[model samples]
Target: MVTGLTLNLFDFQEKAVMQLLDLTTDSRCKQTIVVKSPTGSGKTIILIGFVDEYLNKVNSNTAIVWLCPGKGDLEEQSRQKMMKVAPHRTTQNLFDALRNGFPSESTTFINWELVTKKGNTAIKDSERKNLYDRIAEAHRSGMDFIVIIDEEHSNNTAKAKDIIDHFSAKNIIRVSATAVENKRYEFYEIDELDVIDEGLITKALYVNEGIEDNVEITDDYEYLLDLADAKRKAIAARYQEVLPEGKVIRPLALIQFPNGQPETIRAVERKLESMGYTYDNGMVSIWMSEDKRDLPENLTENDAQPVFLLMKQAISTGWDCPRAKILVKLREGMSEQFEIQTIGRIRRMPEAKHYDDDLLDFCSVYTFDEKYKAGLLATMDKAYETRRLFLKPKCKTFTLEKEYRDLDFDGLGEREVLNRIYDALVEKYHLTSDKQRNRMILAGNGYVIGDEILGQALHGVFVRTDMVAEATSYYGTRKRVDTHKHGMQLLHSTDAIKTAIGLSTGKVKTILERLFRKGGNPKKKLLALNTAEFYAFVINNEHLLRDEFRKITSGMSQQLGLTLEPKKGVFHIPEQDFFKYDPGVKEEIEYLSNAYQEYTSGYATSLVRSISEQLFEQYCESRDDIEWVYKNGDTGQQYFSIVYLDALRHQWLFYADYIVMKKDGTVWVIETKGGESKGKDKNIDPQIENKFNAFKSYAAKHGLHWGFVRDKDNRLYINNTEFAIDMADDHWKPISLVF
Candidate 1:
């Protein structure tokens, strides 16, 4: 845990931080890493945690350079967030770096335009040292730079690359909601669903929700603003009901105008003023490139004053106004592509949590532009109008067996991994304590060992033809390849070894030192190479070592005898669960709650079931013998699960799809999947046979009944006797007959 932090990061954020630390600390990792995290995922907090963890774990002279895009004073905003989250750490800026060389173990936030743009005072040659000079000084002082490019897509110009090159960064992490994929860098994406699951953002984004298709868009601007204002007022009322007594939140509506639309802006202003929102009062605010009005310093707070904000593209990137829940995008003559950044502004929950109120938990967008709506939906798949449903009241006494892990078990630790690697090496090479003999054996087994590492260099050229400007067909008249000795770059030879083997820098070092360090334990030390010779040997045999390590890692689980057994305990279904469904769907079941759309007898869940699961649910509800059906959640302690071992012997919990309580006082557990047919089984899941066998064992031991259910050709099949992939197998029968 990072000390001196004001806010505690969620599990997903902490996981991202650990991944960043692993990449930055490992010399074998890629030079560039892209973080494709969704907006409102607390990316800044994750990076700050990474920085603090890296500094604490590794003993090295390191500096973090956070380069923010030039918008909304994002650099300063990021700096303040860092200070608030980690006040104990030293945070500085470009000017501060100029006055003093890049401070070690500190973060320096720099606006890219300040130093990258030509003729900028910070970049100009003056009495004060420029950014380049400071970077050079930091390098001279043995600082390892880790650069973070926030909103990297916004400023991916040649100048930005040039500025980044000045730092000679060991690692460059580019962060954005819409990060582009590049083969040269490793990608780390935080699933948007995870953020929603954590309740950091709205459950869904509704566009033109509840607007009848028959309605004509004769007046696009006023109609959209009217809808937005009504929704905002409704949300404000919901906030009053859900929030604490002293805490207040006024949901603000943002009206976005396309560039060069002065008349349309005035018309919207008049419309807003008529709706009790005006500049004269404190309810309205406008933020533009040159014009600003009634804006408070802290608009993100719950009790901020502004209830309506009008903006034209200035707050698109890196703006954090959580209370702004409604967006009314008014169009001009030209059609504009709506960026996700604009919608992202309203996605964040004001209190960083959902109030379980549909009116307050969902963000709305009122836009008539088809192109803009398409663009917005293209970015977020879950953005759509949804109607709530509650759990039916008839199934109130539902109970099911839930699997829980044993707290005392700690299987497959780092020590086991290290031992397995060591054993694999010894078994493959037939190693002994005799260092000279081991060297001979290694050389004979295709392992290169010499003063210089041997590598191949290729030289070729394409032949241009008159058929095309640049010929697509290439013909190399002369193909030349020569062997060359690895140069002084061998100094970082461990980097190649670690990269090849997919291990951390420290783990690689520890393994190497244990195996080859001079004057070490005779039993463990298999190689007798000094520090210099060890590096050369590693560089020469990087690929061979990588292959061997890959084999060991892939087979590690198979070699280990680790398995999980569920404890003899069970959890029951909760009284309520939240549910959302597309409003366009006309089928409304009577069992769901009218007020909150909850199932009183179902397990706690916030998931929208898949098509197969929904169909299976409908099947269970229609059955005469079934008393009630409770859906099992995919994860968490509140859900029922069965411990199963995968083919690799790795332990995992199998959460069955539904638990059926029959009228005969018997419980039936069913796992749903697409049935196999002669045509194709595109939805088939791997390693399902293992889960079926585990479920069978669990049922027998606990005196319960279980079945594997699959849908094939509009018919449901049950396999309770034997696990088989073929639908025609003797163990399979129709679900109705089995029930």
Candidate 2:
């Protein structure tokens, strides 16, 4: 029922659009939902249609935020798709929002890195508060934001979560091809078979087609290239047969090579040139970090000139070339984990409709790497298989008190943490602006501040042949690896630092150079080290530096004049909640005459059930005094929770398993854990003691009873105070008395 939309939608896409609208506009207070579909299912177009319909039908003042991952330039790609499909709608980016506050009924696209990366000018303290100002301005205008996280699986980092929380959006929708099942979000899925039925994607994927299974692996890359080229030509010929004389379609082949193999690249180029596909004739193109060649303006079009494209790595996520029908992955001895997105590159139909011809309808892959093939199949088996479960109406009245973080107190940002770490190091290690003095002070405190540059060189024999030339047979292992005074240097010290600290290279470099650079603001600089000395020091002491950084960030260093207090507020259980599961698998739980509903649907059923939970559910069902038993979720904002402090004095949320109500107007909270034996304690949860104490304190203050339950040899035990892992301990008693 969407009007004024230029692009026509298929039946499935239209249904999905309507489903999205209904779910978002429902009366429940649920905040998050999920959309799972295959790669070539036109998910972008479907979302654009939903946005257009929502802006037209709804009356509220609203804005849409489309969040994309930093990889692949996906934000720009999504913006272009929105404009091309719905021309009348208003579209903008982060810069536009900063210049002029978020307009009503507009869609804004933002890349995750711009705000999450440390030292990024967009959110750095030194830069103007553009993002915060725009958010405030939007709030003043009474605009509600609906956030959409595209490719949700790839954007689950802590910093990404922080950015999403910063927006304080009214609703969130996550879209991905391989979305996992969570009890918090309402699930929707578009069947891959439906897409194939609609002719939007290829019918099937043919791996190593027409090759004998018993053949041996060969190092010759020419065989796979020859097969892929022949397939591309055949598909192009089929396209010629179907279309008119004026319209033409040229199918392209993609060749992928492993990284750091320059000799193989040279030989492949020569082989391709012999096959009449050369860079001089505009028939070949390459996409790499250091070199790019002869790429057309729009590579997705069927009539683009390049017939063969070469690349050292997988293409970006949003790179869509419908004319790409074949792939030739050349391996160099080592195994690589194939990415699912790479296979999706060749799966789209050129005309968005499949011809009946077998060669044209199927995509071809000619790779002799069995490991890569196995990995691809393993990833492909878990393709989007999802089912939605409705909330039972009888559970509307069951509510409990919970805890949430107060939004008024935004805890420490990355820059603040970095500052605190720097201050702590400066005071403890007696760092100064003088490099030599600082180095001596650090060395005195057991820091590895060596100024020696070290490296290793491989000594090998050079060999040459008519087809290829390379080095072979390395010798003098320990003697060739010599340490010199100052001749050798580390090439990728930034990368090494990133690996040591588990952060982005940019962030690591910023932390190192900003704190120890030679010429900065005199008051802010802790040590004055030039480029060479700085690199040498960091590379030599990478592990020690990483340990120091983590200790401060993890709240272990307390004398840095910083107080860490987590903001807390009260949380209440929602009136309605949903469950999700994969329908393709035979995993389901059914309960009759349940308190929440007549039965539980889509509740994950496992072959190995938790002994405590199984016994407890049966006990409640059989007892006549029990009024009702409500199951609580493990995580998410919609569930009941209690605030607890860990050993580190950091606040955490504890969610109990069951909330039981008795006919005598008594309520009980229970947590389940594995029981212990006399010889060895078997409980594995590290925070068991902390959670138990918190539960007791909360129940006593709130006028409710609580107990910790465990299972041992088909029997149940309950402990209220003084938790002990051994079942023979006097603190534990039979569950019959508690019931």
Candidate 3:
């Protein structure tokens, strides 16, 4: 049997998960680690690695709890991986061990279904008892207990609560594909994305998800063929890993004819059959002769064994296959979610214990990159968002190693932030451009083509070391020849121009090309890193950024002690985060020892709270507890506010379950959980409440609103009113929050 899996995270620090894992090996880190890897990011593989370590290194008394939205999907995927695809210590050994009776109260895989039932209701009695018995007995028997929860966010109903409570272990680990704010525990992260911006998953080609509408397709069959021709090479390129050792995987043309298009399934099926593939549905075409019309009926089966399944349909959200090495999406309008799921299918670790020296096969075949280009870009947007979201919820705070003040290049000496393209053309690409530096590159792409107008020495140094491939050895470094390749644009900027000024002679060609394209002047100067971030902001997100910025400026956020979570992209800062500083704050301290609401968390406060608490103690240290006067700028009221800096961010920043306030009462006594770093943008439209709805109870809670309110006290009142009104209004139309 394989001894154990070792995840050697030596000196890698690109994304958040690395730090998270490094810290997890320690037992005191009770902080919940929310690894915000985008779909297809190999979240499962990482999890399995962690599980393998915990089971062997920790205690066998560990019982794993796996919560899934769909019981069938969960069992199928897990079983398939364990039996068919897992690499180390064969599944047969596991089955043999299990079948021979290793003891019922031993290492196990459990689903929350033990607590949930039909009708989307919960199982509160027998099921809950059975689950607890297994866990408690297992733990009592000196068995280690580990829980791996899948689709954790779906734990909304009371039944799921039964399961969560049944486990009763605070160490229950949750796994989710979406970017979620943890605010539940300390945070760590891992980013599988090569370049993180708009979304997560990346491939040979990058597509931003938001620009779906910009992508064009045509009704004419010729258009498709023409488009396919453009992407045919790339399509074949997708199959490189799967191709036999020496067999070149070339694009197999897929000609879609209206009626025949549906028949494409049969065509692919026949091809796979010839290639020795089996369908999970189990209709062995070699033996069962099903007519074309009855192909679906013939291929349908409830077989138990896993098979090499080839599905043309976009994989659904719940697919958890360890053996799924390939995914081909035939339709368009592919969302980031779809891409993430497809990527996730192949990323799961092989159940037994084999790690491929080569990364798994991930290839996408599209008629044209143009069609899904925006969606792909949109994917990056989501990935970035998901990353930040996941990290925040996990309660991660960073000091940037160095202070932003020190990191600032302010007053370093103002070099030209703008330069023209004339000198750029002559010196850079060795081409003359009548159009100056302030022009667009490649027309539509956001680049400014230019020669090394600012000169190569300085500018060349700023370019990432890996930006250009080295020239042949005999010739020395590769010439920075003019390139028409599409990529994330560097665009017009002061830093870009200044850096361009110093570009090496070899890199002039690219500098000139970029300056000329984006109407950027090369002689003036290029923009700096932060400036570039501002200028290259996504259009659809401009208003969002502006709104968030507005909230930061608004005094209410300051009054409430809420700060802008820049990394989390679009969350509007609530008033409390800005204004609710523990009165115990002092000079030189960047953050508080504990959040003001720590008093309500039930658990002891963290170090962040202690810093602020120390200051408070200076004021009223001897007193068991103390209250200070608090002001609510929005409601035009003032009242006493209690403090215990140790509270989590959510306790005060999030909405409350209920708050009781008599007309003349000074304080808003409230209950319920606080929110994490950020939540998704929710829209509002006025509506009336129903009789049975908890209108009375809801009306009693006030959560702070971003830019909409002012002061910490305002939060208690604001949160109460916001959700109350939401529950009352909101046209029975629920939001999907799909992104």
Candidate 4:
């Protein structure tokens, strides 16, 4: 029963198509399907889903054509790549239909310029070029073209409608990973929670999203990616297979902003050339628009299609590309339309019954630091049809604090309360930081910046409000309830949020930070650390987490006869106290706990001391250091609760699950957060992260060794490092977070 299905951990396209199929209930109405996914979620695959549906059967051999905004070598190459990425089973089935002359079943990807550009055949070698005329004539031929507008939207409707006229397609399929709908075409949403359960796609979907006022660059990208070994392998495999060896590809990336971008492709091209990579021999060519370089009047496919890249302010819509494998975002985020245009270039082919393994097979993307400016990822999620980036922080999104208070607790469905509260606090309220984000309120219906505005808004919401007070002092804070029970409360209340949508927060320190720049300083050139130390930091903090687990469930702890204690930040778990539980439960928990013990932390019933020692041994590899300690938990007796886990601090002192000798004078100092509940009224318990940051500051003030990091938008980048963005996608956040 739900009309729209929620997204799943996997099988994105399958979920979408199934959602679309549900529309069969309204068989009487001819509906234009509008799908909203990120730039790489595979909308093309969904478009192909209709190649032949047995339930709502639409039969025809001549109803398919593709459209796009450009006619360049890259565009054509993109088309070829798509054909190869389609799922094998579906492609085989579609291939059989294509043999029958069915437009949907038939396969063909051509350049719009090839069909739209007209030349005077009347004269042997026309003195003048009628390239535009040739293209028109081609369209007038009325061939079997089932129109699949790859980048269909208000901006490219003219071209799309024209193609629609020519094909008289039995079925019109518009596939855009980033779709901006002029009209809310019939929507087909998926069951997000059951994405993996359905088993329609592979490896589940992953996503990471947020809207940083002005994004910064950082080294977090490399670190986080390292953990996702399987994903990285898949990406490497796909890249290796597509780009031919000795192709001089160097695996580069590019980003394009709608406007307001400082650097142009030409500028980058010059830089690349200066970098000694300008010797193009057919394989390395850039595409240009309106400025046609048609092989000097005589060119052969084998003779290198001029081996040149094309530069266009904007690519045409309804374009087709099969070889658009790896899209790189080198540009900044300016407007949703422009962002969509860039991502649209590579999302042309669908994985219907026609081209298996080749349809929507785009595996990975490379993005420069700057593409995240102005909350690009979040904005695009609202427009696109094939991708998703969780618009919230991972930990917060998974936390279910508010439900504990409301009687209905209904246990807060996994995706509902947690996703709602966290996504809003992090994305809309900007609660992760101490500063309030500056929203440059874009004007007009197109959401373009620097345009004259009748009026403007921020975060796409709010009428008349500003910074609001939170916690210790007045700063823009997220929704909070002054409750004593929940450790995850905010200083700001839902009531406060309701009273002042836009004006209240203007008075907080968050607003002041946004209004005034702090005294700046530059500090670079730091010592390099490896991955082992990082794991050590996490392992050492294990006790804090277990203790918090204890605090939140003391009753259950007592019932289970479980008592926990921390030695050197490592918790001890008892064994005899464990096996006393239900046989199945004991086995499962033990299995998971033992695996953790073999590596890091563990939790047991009565044998807390022994279990803790064993887990510590596992983490330390039988070393004397207690999980590579900072302050001995056994000595202090005085300790703060673990409320927050500052991701960056641990990153700085990256001691791995492995070991190393304390190099005479080369020990890294990293800060950590006490893992206590944020508490009732302070929805955001930033104290933990703040302490870590403070620790870094102390180290900096004393000329010591330490750094800081805060996890936002699933991944993090540093400041002063922004890039022009073609597009940003969080399509893989969900899958990764789950595993």
Tell me the TM-score of each prediction against the true structure.
0.50, 0.53, 0.37, 0.30
**Candidate 2 weakest ten by summed lDDT:** 460-469
Candidate 2: where is the Cα deviation over 4 Å?
Answer: 1-7, 118-123, 126-129, 258-261, 312-316, 369-739
lDDT of 3 by residue, 11-58 (tens): 222223334445556777763455544454445555555554555555
Once fitted onto the true fold, the runs of candidate 4 whose alpha carbons sit more than 4 angstroms away are 1-10, 19-26, 54-62, 65-147, 154-171, 180-184, 190-251, 255-285, 289-739
Better-scoring candidate (lDDT), 1 or 4: 1
CA displacement after TM-score superposition, residue 494 of candidate 4 (Å): 46
lDDT of each: 0.68, 0.67, 0.31, 0.30
TM accuracy, model 4? 0.30
Cα lDDT, model 2, residue 635: 91
Itemize residue pairs with steric clashes in candidate 1: 389-597, 390-592, 390-593, 390-597, 390-598, 391-598, 391-599, 392-591
The most accurate candidate by lDDT is 1
User: For this target, which candidate reaches the highest TM-score against the unseen true structure?
Assistant: 2
lDDT of 4 by residue, 346-438 (tens): 332222112223212322333322222211222212322221111112112111100001222122232232233333334432333332122
lDDT of 1: 0.68
Off by over 4 Å in 1: 1-7, 127-129, 372-739
